[model samples]
Target: MAEEELQLEDGSKKKKLFIIIIAVVVLLVGGGAAYYFLMGSDEAVSEEMTEQGADNDSDESLTSTTVKTGTALYVAMPRPFVFNVPGSTRDRIVEIKAQLMIRGSDNEEKAKMHVPLIEGALLRIFSTANADDLATEAGKLAIRESALKEVQIALSEITGQKVVEEVLFTGFVMQ
Candidate 1:
């Protein structure tokens, strides 16, 4: 009789421990779900607010240098610029596909309208670059900066504002 009572008591204790563990797991899962849903809703609300704020803001306040907005516009050249330059051993042909980054749609239109001039200026700059110089990363960067400056100057002369924020070489090949 005593042994039977001991067995019953042990069984009861095991059942109680199982119940406690199950409760803990349930609470943890529920808490995690709550946290996830709450955070997700908050982020959605914040994103909507940001969109509304952007819509409310006007473009007139944007200066030539104030491109602190979240968006950047890219305008690709219609054709690649291909030329030959003097390399260390022989003449190397270089082909470059370039793009311009501008702030607003107006600037983008202006840049598109002046594509011929921009291409001519860039080709003039690229023609002066030696194949040996362009073979290195630093040389490429220098060429890009020089091209950016020239494009900015050209656009500024026409628009009375710097239209292009950056000049990027999207594709480059040398052979």
Candidate 2:
């Protein structure tokens, strides 16, 4: 009778232990499923937000357009001018100073129209001056300023634009 009672007690304890283990496993599986669902939704929300941000950036870039502008270029050089010297000896080396003022136009035709007058003005200066006067700094500055004014006027007439503001020394050589 005593052995029979002990066996019944041991069997009941084993049954209860198995039931507890099963309940713990089921709870763990349920928790894992819930976590996966929550993380998946978060990822989907982030992806949608990123895509919308990209679309907004593209639209903003399209709305802002760039405007094209024309540039003024430096004029070319190496043109020679000969001046008449009053007291110049045959072998005497004379210095002549001159500057060319040029303006660029948005229109090619306008630039072309001003080229002749610019060249002509420079040519006339060369025809009148001697080397001794040009050697001085003051003379050179005066010549440059005058040339610039003439070029600006000619360009204004040709291109109808503020052709030139100043003359630049394209080339300066003592010899």
Candidate 3:
């Protein structure tokens, strides 16, 4: 009977060990998935950057024509962008007032129509900028360029043309 009891104990221990091994494997898989999601794919970002660069390159001639065709127009936002940007140590609040430069009444109207979409994209871009990125002149310039690219991309999708000539900041403050 004692031998039988010892055998049962050993069997229970084997079952527990098997369950522990399965749990560890599950945990490892979950960690890998999380890491993959967080890191995403650099290839995707590179592809987008290449596509936008190509679009901008091809539109250079068209850009000049649009400028010459009509009086330049600037559309200002109803309110400044106010948001918090994450940093290594803490969060910083940033406010930016910007104007969109376009040409002709049609593009102006389209720009006005897509204000919300433009704002959404800008907010996404702005929120992702860390304090380190906002603190330096070069970083700020890069951020501005990124903001312009995002606006142009959004407008291109809506109007089937690059409606924005430039994104000029009227006011910028951070704390």
Candidate 4:
């Protein structure tokens, strides 16, 4: 009777072990299947987005290249322009760092070739600014516009085209 009881206990333990192993195997297979499906869906979505982006790019490239001939470029002045301006209270000293935005490589080369002339033109424009006017944003914009016009005129006379599309003031200081 004792031997039969021992045999029944051993059978129950083996059955429990078998059930645990089967559960673990089922979990691993389910997890692997889930990972495979999720990864495949992400790849398909990315491929679709890439194809749509390519189509948009093709449409834009045609219109953009025709409107603008060359890539935009910036040419910086060798030194900042430092000068004095008269104010209602007293005279103030000003410094301006400038750059030129040109449309194409041809214009860039033309601008580089005539840096001295550009500097002189800008200096003349800056010298006329009033300290009181420089303190205001509108005054600063007016001065910038004047500088652009002056530079364009100067370059146009030499290069037969406005080599500079814009005059950018990168830095400004007052004391």
Candidate 5:
């Protein structure tokens, strides 16, 4: 009986070890296959893009006529604008945190260099807003548009280009 029991235990241990080895092999093979498929596809795509680019060199002039914008960058104001606006019933204090969205590194540098001008321009626009108008969505949009225009005009005078593409209000509070 003891010898039979020892044989049975040895057989079960071998079975478990064999199963574990098979599982490990399967996982490694699956991982290798997945890596090959994913990495191979990226290389294929990059090669295709390079070939297409080479073929499109002569067509560059046709595309060049269209205005191309550069990468978008944001420049945040150093401080938020705090002001008082008169509403129908009372005067409310408002705080607006603004960022300037510009295109290209050149525009980014120009905007950073003249942040004071941009801030002043934005403050002038924000100060003109009515508290009641600011309570609605359309009023906020109107102010944003006015701010963009003012900043562009100010930047254009100094940089000879519109350094700012948009005036983004990151935060707004009314009390």
Candidate 6:
């Protein structure tokens, strides 16, 4: 009876030891899977993000011309240190120093409008600029866009036509 009891006790201890080893192996495999999920996929996610971003960017611009046979005209924008709004007390534009040229079409009608309306449109652009805009790259681009729009409007108003498509900046010097 004593021998049988001792044998049973030994078998129970072996089973418990086996259970402990299995638990340790399970824990190790679970930890390995967690690490793989958290750290191993970072590179793949970054590559996918970069590829998607590239696809979303704008296509390159293709240069083209639409003018029927005729002489092209280029007009210089008025050079100004700064232009003030007629009624506003604060001088919004610190420096308005840039030259924009307008390309003309076959009919001089569209081209001729640039000479007369450019001054007023330029005045509007200068009065729109501020000191900070004259200092930064983003600001400069903003000012360029503002001036371009003004030029386009002036062209449209004068010629009763969509004369200028792009306002070319021939020169720009701001302090």
TM-score of each: 0.63, 0.43, 0.60, 0.61, 0.62, 0.44
What tens digits encode model 6's per-residue C-alpha lDDT throughout 19-54? 999999999999999999988799889989778556
Q: How would you encode candidate 2's per-residue C-alpha lDDT over 1-175 as one tens digit per residue?
A: 9999999999999999999999999999999999999988999999998887666556633221121134544444345444444435432234334343333444334544556677776656555555565678886677676665556556656655544434566455544
lDDT of 3 by residue, 1-175 (tens): 9999999999999999999999999999999998887667666788898887667666764332233357789999889999998888898999999898888998899999999988987887887898878989888888888888888778777778878877788998989
> Between prediction 1 and prediction 4, which has the larger TM-score?
1
lDDT of 5 by residue, 1-175 (tens): 9999999999999999999999999999999999999999999999998887666554643221122278889999999999999999999999999988777897788899999998888888888999999999999999998888888778778877767767889999999
- Model 4, CA-based lDDT: 0.86
TM-score computed on alpha carbons, candidate 4: 0.61
After superposing all C-alphas onto the true structure, candidate 5 shows an RMSD in angstroms of 7.7
Clashing pairs in 3: none
Predicted model with the maximum TM-score: 1
What TM-score does prediction 5 earn? 0.62
Against the unseen true structure, what C-alpha lDDT does each candidate score?
Answer: 0.86, 0.57, 0.83, 0.86, 0.84, 0.59
Q: What are the per-residue Cα lDDT tens digits for candidate 4 across 1-175? A: 9999999999999999999999999999999999999998999999998887666557743111222357889999999999999999999999999999878887888899999999999998999999999999999999998998888778778867768867899999999
Candidate 6: worst-modelled 10 consecutive residues by lDDT: 60-69
Q: After superposition, how far is residue 99 of candidate 3 from its true place, in Å?
A: 0.8
What C-alpha RMSD separates each model from the true structure? 7.1, 22.8, 16.4, 10.7, 7.7, 13.8
Question: If the candidates were sorted by their TM-score against the true structure, best first, what order would they fall in?
Answer: 1, 5, 4, 3, 6, 2
* Candidate 1, lDDT over the whole model: 0.86
